[model samples]
Structures are given as structure tokens and as C-alpha cells.
Target chain A: MARSSNGESVFSRVVRILEAFGPERPVLGVAELSRRTGLSLATTSRLVSELVEHGWLERGPDRRLTVGMRLWEVASRASPALGLREAAMPVLEDVHAVVGHHTQLSVLEGREVLFVERLSAPGAVINVTRVAGRLPVNASSSGLVLLAHAPAAVQEEVLAGPLESYTPHTPTGPGKLRALLAEVRRTGVAVCPGFIDERATGVAVPIRLDGRVVAAVSVIVPNDGGAHAQIPLLQAAARGIARAMRPGQE
Target chain B: MARSSNGESVFSRVVRILEAFGPERPVLGVAELSRRTGLSLATTSRLVSELVEHGWLERGPDRRLTVGMRLWEVASRASPALGLREAAMPVLEDVHAVVGHHTQLSVLEGREVLFVERLSAPGAVINVTRVAGRLPVNASSSGLVLLAHAPAAVQEEVLAGPLESYTPHTPTGPGKLRALLAEVRRTGVAVCPGFIDERATGVAVPIRLDGRVVAAVSVIVPNDGGAHAQIPLLQAAARGIARAMRPGQE
Candidate 1:
């Protein structure tokens, strides 16, 4: 099913080459790419040059290569992620203004939750999620909302094993997580306190389209006593986003 | 200077193949790609297979191909665009909340304005800019700010001629555009009405970093009247975004 039995096709090797980059390490030399991808120097060089020629990778003044602007432009245009983000932006802005906290939009991708968009206040509570970044489906409030509506297989597989907890409050066992997920489904909202960090409590609500939950909108509030007002605001924002995403409207 | 005389490098070809996927047409057949890229069918087939193997492209149920989630993940992770967008998001969110219009961040990419982000209210004013899309330098407020701050040679090249006009309000003539650019530099903002469309007004302010303009923040207000209130909010947000992008901050 593949080539290079380095067990990767030229493409998979290329993808492996790209997967090495992150927020921390954006630029890399060919050697670094080869080391990271565990590909040979020759193969890495050839592929790197090819990518550079195509504008998928750009060579900077220091001769380090990074994912090119062209690649970003190409990948971004008309993506499902882009559509959801656009549709949710206005409502998210309203929520952010009223809440004055971290407003985020996430969708289920694979067994994890991928953050599609997020807006933070200058002095808002610290958040671990980033746009295009992923969090475990069992961790963030956005993740729980996404996971609750996720396919049954995904839920079963996630609940089957090793649920990593970021804080003592994060549900580590299957039974508790299942219950929490059930609550999320029933209430159409999830509040995760000290789940990712002790200082923050995340409140999220699901955004649905075509009769299924397609996205989740969340706000990370500083952990405090009773911010009961957040749930309704988030739910209203989610509904606004859902309405916005519908065709022939807005 | 380029190895792509036939205008094909495995990388560039890969980019072309990827670029063919857009918001309106996210999936296409190999033959469609071949025609779209002007690459031979054989070449297109080989490259598409390679791209799919690499996770840069995915095969649909109908045998069409699309830009893959993996590619978007990797590209978005490493892009400089993300850094700019992140720094701008909090402030942009504020502007979106305050003005309740189209809030955008853009940078100069050659002679065009490359929009990195856009946030709009559900019923916000209509705007032509799209995230990851480009607009001509003389036709967008963001473009005007970048043009005003651009190096002399680049500025000259852009102002010389062949400026495409989107509407009568577009500053296409060299003399008038030069004056407009100077005005933008003087006030640190550009107010463009009907430059791209008759019903919209784009007001942009430079986002300065290290005493230089690195990006522009703008809001598209309806031509009807609310333009005045939007400018101050947009300018303040632009300043905030600039401050956030400063070294060792946020």
C-alpha cells in the first residue's frame, strides 16, 4: 500500500517532513527535516528542493525552510474549517464582547478536537488551545461538546482507555467521562472546571447544522464562584453561529 | 533562477494541484486537475497519487481529490500568518465587537494585499476581503496602508501602471494614488470608499511593530453612515495588535 518501506510513500515522507513544524519550531534546515522525519539526507534534500520550487516551502535569508505563505493561502481557501470559522465569527465576537474572555470555536477531527478559531481578551484567562491546534477530546470543554456529538465508535474508542487528565478535575476514568458526556448531550452545554489548568474553567455549547452538532463554541473563564450567566450566553452564541452557518442566511 | 522551465517542479506541481482546490471547488478529478494546471494527464496522475500517499491530498468517495486536513494542519502550524493572526485576534475581536463590522488584518505580499484574517458580525456590513485571499494594492484600504509603508522600489512598481480598478472610487491613476498613499502615511490610516464596491467603505490603520508598519487592520463599514464610529475603534485595535506582536510579549 506504500513505498520507500521506510514504510512511507514519497508523499507520506513529504507529509512527515511537514509534520515536523509547529508553533515552537517553524523554520528548519534540510538536515533538521531529515532528522525529524527519519528520512535519508538524499531523499530529504530532493523533496525539500521540490517543495521549495513549488512555493509550498519558502527559503529564508538564513537558508532555513518554512511552510510557505503560498501553502497557507492554498490550504486556507474554502476549507470546511474556513467556512465554519466565517460563519461563527460574528456570533463569537458578540460573545467575546459580552464575556470579555476567551471565545473559541472547535470541531471534531479524528478522535481529537481541532480548534478552528479562538479570540482572547488581552488579559483573559490563559488558554492552551490555538487555531489549527488540537486538544484531547476528553480535556477541553469545547472538546467535550465535540466529543459528545461525535460518532459512537469515536466515543467508545476514547472511553476504552488511557484518558489523560490535565488536572485532578479532568475525568480520568471511563464511567465519569461517560456521565459527563451524557450531561453535555442532555444540556447541550459543557462546563469544564480545572480541566486543563487550575486557574481556568471552560464553558462551551454546541453549534448544530443539518440536525447534527457540527461545531462547539466555548469561553474560558477564570475559575471563580458561580458564573452561571456564562452558559446562556454561550448557548445563545452557539445558536447564533448555527443560524449564521445555515445557507441562504446572513 | 528556477528549475521549473516547463513550469513544473514536483513541488510547484504539487502546489498547483493543491491550489486547484478552492472554497467553491474543494474537490476535483485528476483530469480536471490536469486541465486546470496544464500538466499532462500522466503527470497529473502520478503527482496526485504521490500527494494522496503523502497526506497532502485526499481521495473522495467519488474518486475526486481535495487538499487534505493533514496538509492544512501542517501548513497552518508553521505559517508566519498564524503569528500575525494570533497577535491580531484579541484586538480584532474587540474591533469586531465594537464596530460590529468586518474586521480584517492584512499584509503586503508583493503588490497585493494578502488578508490574513477577517471577522464579521452575522449581519455586519458587506466586505470583499476573504481570509487568505488577495486584493489589488490600490483597491483595498489595507493595501493602501501597505503601499504607503512599502519600500520605494516596490511602491514605484505598484504605482507605475496597470493598476486594475474595481470601481470608480479606486485609485488607479498614478498621481492620485501617490497622493492617497502619502495621505495614508501622514495620518497612519486610509479611508477608502467604494474602492472595491459601491456600498462599502474600508478604513485601515497601520499596525506598527518596532517603529515600522508590519500590517494593517481595517473594518468595512456600510456606506450608509456609521463610518465615523468605526475608524477610532479600528485604529485602537490596530495599535493594540501592534503592541501584542512586539518581541517577548503575549
Candidate 2:
């Protein structure tokens, strides 16, 4: 492993450089990347050039850098999330057709819910979650179901405190969140009305694989008191996804 | 920018290690990685440990290494492919629903067609393309559509090459490929029957953004006479995807 003058490994610096990019700012100039990563301009330039050479970063016509298709290909082709998304996609489409809103698949990553896939109609309700985006564990129905089935340590960690509130309906107190988790576990579903946004209701159910909850399937629909009607649809879709994900199937 | 005694940079070694993992073999032991990457065991071990610490690589309970979710998240969240896939997904779903087979979105990556998104229903046609997988520029309908609209240099490079034939129907000769490209440009579609598989037919259309062909939308259905009937559906879906991708639309 090569080390910089400051004793940071080259890999660490590379990670910092890659982390500087996000959905909101997919492209950046060398100076902007250096400023964002806090690396020296010379070091950033050297690293970016090396990355571009390897096809991990690409320069557009204007010479701004974006994460290369090669990088996405290498990372995505074998990703665990890809496997789950592939298994869930058919059912997700079915749910999207029936729900006519934002239907998504999410998994617990560390302490947050990372949306792996989402299907939405053109004029559906507004959804803050995008593919590969994360939301706090207490602010979305998918997060609630995942949190309910999460291990005790993870549950305790999220329950420790400081839950970020997205809307007035979002559970902020630990006790309220604990009760919500218990309700989700008991009901095998999570329904949060106006949790993330006042205009949408999120309904989610656990997707099990070999009897363990591995992911959540959710629908975000208009919060017009009809969110619960889609609970059975989501649950059935979740089961179909789990069945499709089983080994020896397609 | 740290270089080894052999003058290979750390970034180069990392790329080699990552490239060793693919859709077929997503997990490997340290020894297997070292063997595949041709790196010293000590160097591979040290670098793997560093990568694991940074969440670029993960060790499963069985002590095998897989690309980490953090790495996938970073690569995917800001990927240009993700933007295109998001734009095409709804139309892809509609196509899948109507075709009852594989509907895919692909882009020209280097000299190959790289599938960015695919929607398939259960028991659909036997299609080999997976999301993030690549096919030769002359072996599939999506590839042909993209290659037909690619820059002259790219077209010439592919034209000058030894095109790999998957089936007898595949166009392996430059003259035939040239005719195919001309036909795709003239008719705005590519319909390759049994090019990759004897049981499937691929139909594709170009997707334009700002009057420049940006991607290809394709469907793989059973090799029946009905393949031509799908051309209009595919063209409309392509137009919808292009309109959806327009700036400030969503």
C-alpha cells in the first residue's frame, strides 16, 4: 500500500475522492474535487488522471469528471443489491401497476434504509427516495419494517436517541419509535402516514428469505386514507419477491 | 500516486483486484484474489484489509471477500447510467408488460453494448443480457442500434473487426454488417432474429436526446413472426424515454 506524506494510504485518498461525488453533483472539475475532498490540487490531479486512465472516472466533453460507466459496471454487475433488485423487479412492477405510485425495495444499511429499486408512474405522488438514496430509519415505512426485524444491537443503536424528524408525523421519541416497531412486528407491516411528507403515505412489508427478513417492499401513495388498502398487495408482492429470490429458481 | 517496486501504482493494483470479481464470481478468498490479480500474497492481504476498513470490500461470515455495499452505493448513486436508467424505467416497464419478455436499455460503451437496465417477467424469453452486462456490437439488436448511430470512428473500428458470431444468422462479414447499419439508420430500427439465440428475436430502436442518438431501447421476444409488430411499440417507448430524460421534466 502506498502512503502519502501525511501517512494516509492511497486507497483512503481514492475513497475520499470518490465520495466527493453524489447524485446531486455527479460531475465536478479538478479544483472542485480537490476542494470537496480536501486533498492538495497536485495530489487530486495526479489521482484523477490515474483514475481516468483506469476508467474509474470519465471526463465529459467539457472536461468535467463523472463516475465512469466502467466503474458502475464493475461495481453493479456483482452487487448483492443487484441480485435482490433483480429478484424483486417483476413483483415491483406488478405492485407499481396496481398501486400506481412509487413502489420501492429497500434494505437496511448500517443505521439507515438504502433504497435499492423504485418504480413510479410519471405523475405519481412525490417521493423523496431515489434509487441508491438513504433515509433515516424512523422516517420511512420501509425503514420501520427493517428496523423492527433488525437485530437487537441495531435496534438499540437507533433507539439511543436523536432521530431526525422529516414531518410532524415522523416518530421522534424513542418510546414512540419502539412502539411503532413493535406494531410493525406484530402486524407484519408498517404504515406511516405523512411521515416523510405530508402528501404521501408509506406502506411496507418485510421480504423474507429463508425465514429471515432481508429487505422491505414498500409503496408510497397519496395520503388520502387509502394507504392500508394496498398493504395486502405489498405483502403478496413481498412474498413473490422472496420466492423468486430463492436458490434454484430462475 | 504511490508506486510499487515494479512501478505499478496502487490504483492500478486496486483496479486489477476489483476487475477480478465479476457477475460469475462475486466472492473469493484472499489467495484466490492474489492468484487472479497476480499480486503478491502479502500485498493482496494488506490491500484487502485496507479496502475492508474503508468499506470498499467486505468479508462474509465464511471469510470470503465480496465488493462492499458502500462501494456499490458510491458507484451507483452518482452513475450517469443510473440517470438514463431512471428515465427509461417506466417505458421499459410498459414494454415488458406488453411484450411479456425482456425489455432493456443499453448504451454504447467502448465497442460493446452495455445493458444499463432490463425488465423481465417470470418465464419470459430466454435472454442472456443482464443489467450491467455487455454484448458485442454485432451480436444483439440493441448493440446494432447503438453501433449504427455511433461516431464514424467507432463504427469503422467495429466494422474493421472480426465480429464474433453467436449464431449463423449473426452478421459476421463487414459487408453484411455495413448493410445492417445502413438499414438501421434508414428504417430507425434493428430487428435481429436469432442473432444471439435461435429461440429469441431482438428488436430495438434508437433513443435520442437533443437530436443525437444517446441509447438504445430493445426487446427480446420469442422468434415468432410477431417480432415486426413490436417496432412501433419500441419506437414509441424510445420517444417516451427521451422525453422523460429531457431536462426539467421531472
Candidate 3:
């Protein structure tokens, strides 16, 4: 959520302050946050002071500010990502060890694939996925598997809009994308070569919880060799994750 | 922040609504939520309606509301737990593969040991520790290591408090705990036995970043062994995590 330059509400301002901290800019000073948020310096100072007092933000020894442990603790105790991510990590780890590549778990959020966990090798094939990061629902194999199982309206929304092409192989046409999704649902796996990068391919299978496709488990491997063989491994991992989500079933 | 009994802010109400959803109960009806939150049915309905509109909560096909991916994405993206966790996974995986027990990462937060990550084997020793969970600063080995290195004020506050004992061996007297902390600092390893549970011992070592102890790496093993033997392994793993955390180290 965003607000106008000069008339933003306090809640929107707090959201903006948190949003200003990203992967590349994890820590910043109040002045930098003020500049980035387009808020007055005095307002920025007041807001940062309030947030810090509430334990939502913490100032480092260098006078730079970052997200607070309290906020992380609260958020971690929040059930959406933490519970599913916790259940998936061990299975994701198993897949990573077995596949000797990058293993990731993601869910469909709006029109993007929001990564929950990713485990990678030191010199694994370069993967663009990052934990808590997003990829277009039509660009990555995990996204496609999720987009395939998504409701028709969500699919229509994604297919009707801007489809970003991270690499030349990323399917941009809505018609081709629709066909790809249909194939994904039919086959129960999405395999893509050079969809996000030329040298990497993504293979994914949907993870179901309570008979719904709640998440997707995927692996990133070199574009060469039998990438197709990775499908069963991913499916097994997905089954394990689904079972973990449903404890009694496990 | 908790508001006085009545008239809570919408954000606070939304947070309370979220807190109602836990790992045990991931989904509930709107009425069930209201009953759990003590909010009027109308107020709960309206707030939950807004949450659904904002994608912070989603309704499943069964008409049950569950923690939505949007909330997860926002909280996860803003979390301090993510960066260090990403760097530690490979190293923790290595240790997990060899040790076949729980491997945990913790940081001192407000005189408590806040666990950022914990990887456990399916049939590993039962532990009370949860990822993003807190342990008393004097009860667990990780907490002991963190408390030993905490600022003097934090140390004093904990020592001045009424310590709660989980088991017979849990040190409750401030004087004894203070001595134990000193011993932990001297040995570079915190050995806690029968504190959390009588069947287990926690072995922890501080992980240094830029020569300051930033976190603690720990493992839980059966209490029967000489815990001193596990120190080298935990210390080496902590060093590995520290090396991974260094700037431009990866």
C-alpha cells in the first residue's frame, strides 16, 4: 500500500518506512528514509522515533536503523509463512541434498510467486529466486504450477496484465501461457528451460494441504542433463511437505 | 501494543485477529474468530472483511478464513530473521547432516534468547524450542551464552528477576546463575543440563561477527554424554556461520 507524497496517513507512512528496507538496502539512516519516502524530515524523525519506541525498529551502533528483532519475533509467530516454512524446510533440505542444486518453496500471492524458503549449493546453477522475494506468476516454473492451480479469476487477472519476461524463453503471450498452465495441471508438474535465466531451468510440483494447492515445491538445475528426472524428486518432497502440514497424516 | 480493554485501533485489532490464528488452528470461521478475539460479531466481520479485501486473510473453498500470503509476504520481507538465516542454512545443513539432531540459531533480544532458526530431525529429541520462539536467558545453553555476552544492564535485569524453573536442575538463584554465566564466558561454551528437560542437555557456542558475539549456535543431545565433546563441533559450526556472515565473504 502507498500514499500520496504530502498527505499520507501515519499507517501508510509506517508501511513505507518498512518497505524502504530491502535486500540491497537493509539498513538506512533517518535522513535517507525521509528522502526515499518523500516525507518531511521532521515527520520522518517523529515516525522513526515512535517505531523504535514500539520495538518495531532498532538503531544499530553505527546509527543506521534496521527491522527490529521484536517485529521479526512477532512476524515469525504469525502463522501464514512461519508454519508452512517450518514444515517445508526439512523436506526442502532433503531435496537440495539429493538433487545437489537449489531447492525452493513458494506460494501464489496475488500474481507473483512469493518464495518462503530456498536452499542452495555453493556453486549451484545461478537462480534468481530469493527468500521472501517475488517472481511473476507466469515466469517461473513454481509460479506456473501455482498459477495453474489458482482460481480462474486469478488466472484471468494474471493473463490479462503485464507479463514480465526475465529471459527470452519466458512465455509472455497470454494464449501460450494459458496452454502452459493447462499442461502443468494435466501433468502435475511444470518444467521450464531458460525461463528465468539462460543457463538454468526450473521444475516444480504443487503441494496440497487439505485437498487444495496451498504451495509449490521446486528445484533449480542446470539447463543441461536430465532435468526431467527432477520431477519425481520434487513430487516426493511436495508430498512430504504436504504430509508435514497435515501432522496426523504424517 | 495492547490497547486498554476497549476501543483498540483497527491495526491493533487486525493484529489480534491474526494472533488468533496459530499453528494449531490455521483456519476458522468469522464467528469463531470473533468468539476467540472477544470482538463484537459486527466489528469482527467488518475488520475481517477489510482484511479479505486487502488479501491479508483469504477464504478457502470451505468458507474458512486462513492466514493469507500477503501478510506473510509483508512480514517476511521486513523480517531481520531472513538475512542471517539465508547465510546460515548451508552451514546448518552440514551440521544437521552429521549430527542428526536439532541445530538452532539464536540472538539476544530484550534479555531473552530469540531463536531465528531451528532445524530438527523428524525423530530428534523433543525440544520446546520453536523457530522465532524465545527461551529464558538463564534456562537454555543458547540463552546462557547470549546472556553472558549481553550488555551489563540486561544481565542485571535478569539477575534481579524472579527466575522460573522448568525442572529441578534449572538454576533459579541469581547468585548461582551469575557464577554460571561467568563460567560460560570463560569456557566459550554453555552446558545446560536438566534445565529445559531432564532427558536432554543443550550445548551452545557464541558466533562472532566482527569480533563481537552476534548470535549463538547450539545443539541438543542426550544428557548421557560428556557435553564437552560437542563444544568443538558447535564452535566450528559457529565459526563457519561467522565466516559466512562477513562482508563479501560469500
Score each candidate by Cα lDDT: 0.83, 0.93, 0.84
Chain B, TM-score, each prediction? 0.93, 0.98, 0.89
Docking class of 3: acceptable
lDDT value, candidate 1, whole model: 0.83
Q: What is the docking quality class of candidate 2?
A: high
Report the lDDT tens digits of candidate 3 across residue range A1-250. 1233555445556667877887778889999999998878887887787778757788988978998876666555655788898888888888999999999999888789999888989999999989889999888999999999999999999999999998889999999999999999899999999999999999999998878999999999999957999988888889889989886777
lDDT of 2 by residue, A30-87 (tens): 9999999999999999999999998889999999999999999989888888999998
Pairs in clash, predicted candidate 2: none
Q: Residues B1-250, candidate 1, lDDT per residue (tens digit)?
A: 1234564444556667787888778778999999998888987898888877656788878998877766677779778899889888877766776676788899887689989998766567678778988999999999999999999999999978699988888889999999999899888788888888899999888888888888898889888765766767777787788777886774
Q: Which ten contiguous residues of candidate 3 chain A have the minimum total lDDT?
A: A1-10
| lDDT ranking, high to low | 2, 3, 1
lDDT of 1 at A166: 91
**Highest lDDT against the true fold, candidate:** 2
Q: Give the alpha carbon lDDT tens digit for every residue of B167-242 in model 3.
A: 9999989999999999998999999877899988999999988878889999987788666777888888999898
- CA shift of A97, model 1, Å: 1.7
Q: How many backbone clashes does candidate 3 have?
A: 0
Best to worst by TM-score, what's the order? 2, 3, 1
Q: Scoring each candidate complex against the real one, what DockQ results?
A: 0.46, 0.85, 0.45
Write candidate 1's Cα lDDT for A1-250 as tens digits: 1356445555566677778888889889999999998888988998888778767788998999988877788888857778788888777777888888888998887788888888887678889988889999898898899889988999999999688889989887999999999999998889888999999998888888878899888899998955557988887788888887888875
